[model samples]
Target chain A: MDICDLGIVDYEDALCFQTDLWRKRVEKKVPDTLIMVEHEPVVTLGRVADESSMIDRELFEKKGISVVSTGRGGNITYHAPGQLVLYPIVDLAEKKRDITFYIDFLEKTAARALNRFGVPAGRDEKRRGVWAGGRKIAFIGIAVKRWVTFHGVAVNINNDTTPFSGMHPCGESDIRVTSAKEVLGRELDMSEVKRVFAERFVEDFGREYSSQFVVRSS
Target chain B: MGKMELRLPEISAGGEDVVITLWHAGEGDYVASGEDLVEVSTDKATFDIPAPCYGVLERMIKKPGEKAKTGEVIAEICTDDI
Candidate 1:
């Protein structure tokens, strides 16, 4: 598990980098790597998601936000500055190869990170993500192939929450969205958040396999 | 025993948060197990969230186009009576 924090990058560049990295890693072109990055505001649609999910596509385009369709499992979501996005291009076959378990582990790791920030985030038994005080604070969507994982979680830090109004987030209509900064009523240092996340990932992955996990920086 | 939290699953390479593009199942709908419940979008790609457990669609926490964090609940499924 190599952890590389790619501080704030454009959405397109990061996407290209992840896809290429995943392709290369699958073909033995790269080592196990965890790349972190933040992106400008953008909306992405998933494979099975319907176009009707987007309430106002034109409005988003007018604002210079791009909407892209992807191959992962889940609907649309937003990405912007102040949010920490992590892409773990690791060979899941080398790490037990259980997709469901892997997803659960991600949720647990994210919940733990939030807990470290005193947010008390935890997994909801009925749904699939971490929650705090009845509001969603994080989102996870990923794709796995030949037991390898691409695409990861997004933890809200200081990003704006207004754009979320354009669509039914994750296809649900009643839930209110929130962020770490909003929950804590203050801004968090992005660097510190990334550090805690990296440490938490190492701990979570190590505990899952009962071995010492080393994160290599790219 | 209480409301379950639905978190986002990794769909693409970058760590960028996605925008909610659609919701397949709406509130109060009877969703079976393994049904496509919701869809979330990211800059690199899009993905659909399947129902992990079966029950009635109870509540929706987030709407389309909204940014969902990695492990936050986007909706709730009520299985208490089912």
Candidate 2:
């Protein structure tokens, strides 16, 4: 998989970039790519998200964080400048063609990436994200078009988790959100996290997709 | 001319719940092969099911917000050209 790092982009900018790339991928004009981005502080709501999921709107407004409704599946999520968001644009038709398995793969892949940094993380069966010591560490929400995928996973690396409290993160009101920094008691290097995550993502995909699936790590 | 049934493909072996979230085409609308017909979402992923062949959409069996099952017909397309 090719890797493109658009560092500290606005949410709308990344969305447009991902949309264009997604269409290209669907048309088979481009190879499968992994897009890494750290979005400016923003709260995003999925297509099926209901208004009731939002709470504390003033917190975001006071912080000047923009709220945007997006097309990914899930309820609500917050993204910030330090969050490590990985948007893997893959063609699943040539892959396993299973969205559930794909999502699960994303969660597990994120868990492994976090583990590489000494953060013990794994997927929660009841909730659909990576959890570490009962605190949600990563969020997985994706959108697919014509068997091609976009809008991948987001892991709380060195980001602010305060805005997440404003909305029910992934629609779970009682969920406790944590970051790699909080877990390890030190701020993580963003570039290092990206490198590890890119490596782990490539490794897991290559293992699952067999020899024909060629993916080079960043 | 024949009518083709667009079935919801298997999203997972884990019995993950699927719901039809959006329909891009309506009854009497022409859709090309590979054109998105509807959007279905599982727990954490949303997928757009494309039209299998060029045709006019006859009707939708699964509307937005309705549960979808693997292999169940979600919409019908008439294969006749206008």
Candidate 3:
């Protein structure tokens, strides 16, 4: 597993990069990878997002937030510079070969990482994504091609959550969005958060990405 | 040449039941090996199942919007070149 931390990437550039990585992994050219990045403020719509889930077009334009249609499974979601996004390009054929299991793994990994930071995060069966209290602290929307997964979890670290107010998040307008900073009452080091997240992810799926195969970006 | 069975693969964990969402290859259509032939949703998300071998689609045991189980042959392909 190669962990690449692309600091402050544009949303469209990240999508193109993920697509290329997905194709490379599908062809067995590269080992399984986890691409981590924080996007410049933007809103992305998944395969099922409809007009009702989004806010007015002029509002988004005025705020300078770009709206993009993503290939992942879920509804509309927000992203910003302080959010930690992890796109794991994992080949499920060699692992569990099950989408449900893979998604469950991601949810577990994120929850465990949050637990280490003294934030109580868990999964809600009715609503996907990890939550702290009744407010959502993290979101997940993935797309798998040929059993290789991409477009993963987004964890709010210290970002301004005001932009999320512009639309219905994850198809629920009343859904509350929380962050690690809000829960901890202090801003955190993004790199340290990424470190803990990477460690927990390895702990969750270490069997597949063993010590000998794991790679980290400097 | 024999007929190749295109079964509803076990794409999700837990249950094998799924809903046939789409069929890209209809009966009598020539499909190449590894081409997407059908799609099914397992109460979560839709997944496209690819053809196992190059052949003409001979039959569709399961139609779109119908319920199916894992390992059930949804479609059959005559492996003989058409």
Predicted structure with the largest lDDT when compared to the true one: 2
| CA error at residue A5 for candidate 2, angstroms | 0.9
Descending-lDDT candidate ranking: 2, 3, 1
Please state every model's RMSD to the true fold in angstroms.
Answer: 13.4, 3.5, 5.2
| Model 2 Cα lDDT, one tens digit per residue, B45-68 | 788888999989999998898997
**Could you tell which candidate, 1 or 3, scores higher by lDDT?**
3
Model 3 lDDT per residue over B1-82, tens place: 6898877777875765877767887798899878778866543355667888888999999997689987888888998755
The whole-model lDDT of each prediction reads 0.76, 0.88, 0.83
Rank candidates by TM-score, best first. Answer: 2, 3, 1
Query: Using Cα atoms with residue i matched to residue i, what is each candidate's TM-score against the true structure?
Result: 0.69, 0.94, 0.83
Better by TM-score, candidate 2 or 1: 2
- iRMS per model, in Å, is 8.6, 1.3, 2.7
What's the best-to-worst order under DockQ?
Answer: 2, 3, 1
Error of 1 at A8 (Å): 1.6
Candidate 2: tens digits of C-alpha lDDT, residues A62-111: 98888898889888999988899999999988887778878878998999
Model 2 ranges off by over 4 Å: A211-218
DockQ of each: 0.06, 0.75, 0.35
Model 2 residue B49 lDDT?
81
